[model samples]
Target: MVSLAPYVLKRPWLTKMLTPAANWYASASGYRQLGLRYDDLLEEENEAVQIALKRLSAKEAYERVYRIRRSVQCSYTHKLLPKDQWTKPEEDVPYLRSILAQVEAELAEKDALDSMTVIKKH
Candidate 1:
């Protein structure tokens, strides 16, 4: 609830004239790097990501989304898909059809996640 400046100022060891001010400013700057306000700075990053159900083009937007997801190890490739094999496993039509079903299921799950993320927040 308290701002960084006052908190830093209260600690004598952390304060020496403008040093506390500078330190607080630097700390706040780091929060800005994380796209946070100083007062809301310590809140979970996931808290903000549940903003809204923005529309997206499938392939290109998907690439961007997965890049960020992979950056955070939250993508299917990071979680479920393996390094050696992705897409339909090397199998006959029935096997491939089952794999396609699983893929569709995964895609639907991802969509449901993205859609429902904002429900509570909204």
Candidate 2:
């Protein structure tokens, strides 16, 4: 599956571009009152996720554990997508099937647009 997380992190400005439309409060959650910049938000989220991992107490079980927060960039991001939103992937956990479905749908759309170059060469 193609993950959008890396793309967003590489282009940090995308966060700024997305923020004007975001209803920031809900996005900030516990760190809401810090008055942090978008970059700072990454740090705050990383800390929270680290704490959660510690709570699990299984950090040593994995050679590497990385927690990445993707999706729901803003307070406006509410309401989970309906299961029917996705067509379903063959190898996907029932819990994660919706995510795979959404990503697959997006990849399909991008592929189609790229295929239609609209050119005629002699």
Per-residue C-alpha lDDT of model 2 across residues 56-105, encoded as one tens digit per residue: 33552131122122123322464333444322222211322343346556
What's the CA error at residue 5 for candidate 1, in Å? 68
Clashing pairs in 1: none
lDDT tens digits, residues 1-122, model 1?
Answer: 55686776798776677775665665445322322223232222432222211222356345545434443453333453343322222211121233334555667788898888444654
Q: Give residue 118's error in model 1 in angstroms.
A: 3.7
List the candidates' TM-scores in order.
Answer: 0.21, 0.23
The TM-score obtained by model 1 is 0.21
- Best candidate per lDDT, number? 1
Off by over 4 Å in 2: 1-93, 119-122
Clash statistics: count for each candidate: 0, 0
Candidate 1, run of 10 with poorest lDDT:
87-96
